[model samples]
Target: MRPVGLALIALAALIPLFWFAPLAASRDPVALFSQYLGTAALIVMGINQFLATRVPGLELVFGPLDRIYVLHKWLGIIAMVGLGLHDIIDADMDGLRGGPLADAAEDIGEVSLYGLLILVLASVITFIPYHLWKWSHRLIGVFFFMGAFHYFFIEKPFANADPLGLYVSAFCILGLVSYVWMSVLRPLAPRGHAYKVASVRHINGLTEVLLEPRGRGLKHVAGQFAFLSVMGGGLTEEHPFTLSAAPRDDRSLRFTIKDLGDYTSRLYRELKVGMEATVSGPYGNFSMPSGRDPQVWIAAGVGITPFLAFAQTLKHRESGPIKLYYCVRERGDIPYVADLQHLAEETGKLELMIVNSLEGVRLTPERIVEDLKGDLRNAHVFFCGPAPLRKTLKNSLVLKGLRASRFHFEEFQMRTGIGLGRLAVWLWDRGIYAIEKRRAEKTQPAE
Candidate 1:
């Protein structure tokens, strides 16, 4: 399995070990384990807060920002499970209850657990409105504060100044600081590049936003994305959008956004020229492959944004004979086709293929091999598209003689989950398809 920020996991695991080391000889094993569970869970919660801070260079400890968010979600789930188990076992030491303060701490812990449950539910349930979810998410630190208070004040098997106690206190302070920096200080004093909207255009179902820098701008490679916080026109939330244009000296940026969600719809309808926006990134690891290798570039719908930058950066005709497959619902749905076509014709290196799914044109692995008509042993394949399309094409192409190592793609998703909504439907569909295929083969004449 890929590393889900193993640093955090190791820290959480080790803390419990340290806490349980001296107490291993204690006769009350049940209570000891309960205390262990609570300590581990609280540590995990602290790690989650740090992950959410999105501090620069954190991608080194964690993976990319996208993967960090995914890890954050899972850590939240694990922390909740640990907390629940701790509560179920009733975390209490034998004959060590301090009077009134312990009672209040216990009450505080209960309240924090319930609060976290509601907030985590709000986060995981996809149907919740994004704005409301964001609002609930910001309040998580308050409950974390309560939890830290409980940890300090409650009657425990060890003194507050002991090694484990100091460690937990350190985590609590770090988590709280991270929380305050991200949700409180960052908003009042932004850390991103300042820019003003130079232009805004609506093309078909997409919105192209052009931003000119107000001061020093974000320096980023093509295909990397940045979080945009537009100031006015009912757009208060910050959202990540990929820069569609290549990097330039002037530092102006272009974001080609599709009107798919509430925020994007509002941006498309209400955003005006001259509106101020803050760009909080220069994030993601997605970029063009280096060196001279015959390449296959595939994009679907708005997935074409990153490839637009890729196309713009192709300066030398000798660098590549890159074959670009632009998959669209219809030919008319794209506004950048002419730009790509012009570039291809000028360079004599890039080949543009538009696959219109509305027509009967489907891009399959067979088609790719036929078009190449050569050995695929050293070819690099880069793709950005819907998950289903990526899965189908990646698996099929690998079977059809493409090197698994040569195939490249980025997960690039921010709000991934445990697939609670589509898991059942997907399993059902796969089962039905298999049964029908088997039945059809049985009924057919022997081939």
Candidate 2:
């Protein structure tokens, strides 16, 4: 029922064609396979560039922008690994013609491979600062350009007229075009609706930015999100945030951003009213079901943003009985509590339930089913939360009477790594913290 990324599937399907052409040039399978890998890696790199462009209608193809990013990350890793193998395998054809251009291309190829390997390492090691990581990521296009040059000039088994050469050349062009569009052209001509900050509110460690359109505004479904770039207070990077408020007559937008990272913390401290902002999108399909079916909404922490938008819109739209569960660590952590409570009372079709985990209360599937009066046969369950909680609830609910399809969450966006990388980061953080504490203790005056 979910999108498996049609573009990725098509790439996989086309890979065998790379193997077919290079086989004629060499009887040794190792050399031929390496050539196939080189070509395939180029194609993957091209598509990877395309995916990073943040072009409209990509969510339709890739499911969600977050998922598209996830795919982009993996594809890049695969391309790097594939190219690494291709280089190491020594796929050079015997008695190939050489020249100054070929010699330069060979040297460039080596540099590009090592450069890509370093960039790939930077990507995998997630602890790097975002700005640095982003800057390093931009240099990938340079390497891609160099790699393209190397591909064309270097002595290889196939001629330029060959099918393999032509096919790989097409992808190289695609990558170059995408790179130019994103890095060179897109910045000069910005995308998205221009707006000025109408108001800024800090509540419960979250920054709520209200923006009013300077010209034409954005139109969006209640549950969709937008990428916002605040042009003032030293903030220029675009970050995705869900529109917490429903679309209004004035066409103003509201983004409830948590101060979780460096950019957000800076924005929270520095962003002011009347500062200009640009917002692009209305992306994602994570909206309410169209049909008037009973629904159970589960939200944890800041995951309540979309649900808040949904509740605000419920006055106009007709829907079946909806039981909304707001899960939080403590009472103070709940955002828009009074608004949600008012909405529940104002709309007789809605019910609000608060689950406080800090008070030793857990929102288990059993509790949800019990609250629903043991009927999940007809109710759709929509959730936004931590990945582990989602997994636990989904698996437990499916074990019960709830159908697997009925339990829906932004699975790709909420994915957790397989623990190893996360564990290493956790250990690294603890070690740094302990070292800092000991240093501070030594510097302190003793009685």
**Clash counts for all predictions:** 0, 0
lDDT (10s digit) by residue, model 1, range 1-447: 136568657666576576686786873778778888888888888978988888887887676776678778888988899889989996676778675688899999999999998888778887787878888899999999998888888888887788888888777888899899888898888579999999998888999999999998989888888899899888868898889999888999999999887999999889999899989888877776777778899998888898898888887324657899999987555779999998888877799999998889999988888888765666788888887889898998888888997887766556655777798789999999999999999999986
Which lDDT tens digits does candidate 2 get at residues 1-447?
A: 125675554665376565465466555567767877777888889888988887876776777776677777777888988899989997777767865699898889888999988987787676677779888989999999998888888887766668777878888898999999999999889589999999999989899999999888999988888888988777989878889999999899999988877889999999999898999897777788777878999999888999999999889988999999989987554788899999989988789999898898888888888888888788899998788888899898888888888887764242223355878889999999999999999999998
Among all windows of 10 consecutive residues in model 1, the one with the lowest summed lDDT is 1-10
- Error at 138, model 2, angstroms: 1.1
Q: How close is candidate 2 to the true structure, as a TM-score?
A: 0.88
What lDDT is reached at residue 175 by model 1? 83
Provide the overall lDDT of each model, using Cα atoms, as 2-decimal numbers.
Answer: 0.84, 0.83
Candidate that scores best on TM-score = 1
User: Candidate 1: which stretches are off by over 4 Å?
Assistant: 1-4, 316-318, 331-333, 372-377, 399-406, 424-447
Please give the lDDT score for candidate 2.
Answer: 0.83
